[model samples]
Target: MTNFDKILEVAQKRQGQSQPLKLQDSTVLLEQIKNREQDTRPLNLKHIESLAESIAVLGLIEPLVLDNKARLLAGGHRLAAIQLLKEQQADKYLHHFPDNRIPIRMLPFDAESEPDLALQVEIAENEQRRDYTPNEVKAIAERLRTAGFIDVKGRPKKGQKPLMPALAVVIGKNLRTVQRYLEPNQNTEQEKSTTPVVLLKQASTKLKQWQKIEPKTPQEKALAKRLPELLNLIEDVLSNEK
Candidate 1:
C-alpha cells in the first residue's frame, strides 16, 4: 500500500465512529497555531481563476479538511475558490455564506502540538489522496528543519531540520529525499559548500533524462537539441536569487 493508505488505515482504525464527524462554523476549535494560513503551494492566478470558475459552476464537491476550530490544515486555494464563488453568488443567494457551506470531512489531530499535527495531517492527506507539490514539500521540509528536527541518522545543518515521517509520506518521497533539501550536504565531508547543488543535480538529471530520443524521429531530435539550452535558461532564471 502507499504511505498514504497506511495513514488512512490508521485513522479508520482509530475512528470513534465509522462515519466521519461534522461540525458547524460556530463550533469553537482550539487554536494553537502561530503560522498564518496561506497557500504555501503558491497557486497561480490562472489556476485560481479556473478553480473559482469551476467551483462557481459545479460547487465544491469535496469539503476541505480542518482542525476542529475551522483552521485550515489543508485546501487553502480550494477554500479561496469556494469563497470567491460564494462571494460572487452571495447577492443572488443568502445571508451569511452561500454555496452548500463548502462541505468538509473532518479528521481531528489528537497529537499534542498543532504544528506537528498540522504537518502530519497534511502529509497523510497528501499520501491518502494527492495535492502535494515538490515546492510545498520543500517549504515544509525547510520549516521542520528550522524547528530542529533531525534526520534519521541525526546529522544536522543550519536552516535544515528533519521532517516528521508523515509529511514525507505525502510528498511521495522518502525521508532521505526530504532531508536532501533539508541538508543537501548533511554528511558529505568534501562538498559542504555546494550551493543549490541538489537543485543543480535535479536539473542535470532532468536534462539527461530528455536525451532518450529516437535519432530517426524529427521532433525527438529537435526536442533533444533544445534540452540543454532549456535547462540552462531555466536554471539561470530560477537561480537568480532575486
Candidate 2:
C-alpha cells in the first residue's frame, strides 16, 4: 500500500469509523467551503478548466473529504473548478451548480488533539496529485529540510521510504531525484544575473514559432492565444528591468 493509504488506514482506526460519514446538510452551499485555501498545491488554471468542464457534463463522482469543522481536507482544486463552472454556467438556459448540493466525507479527528494527523491528511491528499514542477520539487525539499526532517541515520534515506525520505516518498520520486532537485545551481553569481535583452530575444524567436503552429488541443489553443499577451508582459518586464 502507498504511504497515503497506510496513513489513512491508521486515521480510520484511530477515529473508530470504518465507514465514511456524509456531510449532514443536503443543501450545503459551496460558499461554505469558499475562502479556505491553505493547501500547498498551486492552482493550475488549465487543469481546473478541464476538470470543471468534465464535472459539468458527468457530475462529481468522488465526494470531497472534509474535516469535522467543514474545512476542506482534500479537493481544493475540485472545489475551485466547481466554483468556476458555476459562474460560467450561471447564464446558461438549463444550467445549475454542478449539483444542487456537494457531498463530503467527514474526517473524525479533532484538529487540536491530532494536529499531526491532520497534516498527514494534507500530505496524503497532495501525494496523489500531479507531478510537481522541478522548481516546485526544489521548494518542497527545502521546506522539508527546514522542518528538520531527515533520515534516522542523519542522511537522505535509501529507496522509497516514507517521512524520512521526505519529498521523495510524498511526491513518489526517488531519493536521487529529490537530491538533484535540492542541489544548488552551479552557476556563479555573475552568471545567475539575467538581462531582459536576452529574455526578449529568446521570447521573440519562440513567439514566431508558436504563432505558426495550427493548435489542435485546447491547451495548445490557449497557449497560442496567450502568446501575444505573454510577449507584451515580457516587454513590460524588460522595460521595468531597464
Model 2 clash tally, residue pairs: 0
Tens-digit per-residue lDDT, 118-177, candidate 1 = 666666565565444445555655554554544554554555533455345334456666
Off by over 4 Å in 1: 1-39, 91-100, 110-112, 130-242
CA lDDT, candidate 1, residue 183: 54
Whole-model lDDT per candidate: 0.52, 0.61
Enumerate clash totals for all models, in the order shown: 5, 0
lDDT tens digits by residue: candidate 2, 29-55: 576764344666677785676556545
**Top-lDDT structure, candidate number:** 2
Alpha-carbon RMSD, each predicted model? 18.1, 19.8
Shift in Å, residue 14, candidate 1: 12
Residue 238 lDDT, candidate 1, scale 0-100: 62
Error of 1 at 94 (Å): 5.7
Q: TM-score of the candidate numbered 2?
A: 0.41
Clashing pairs in 2: none
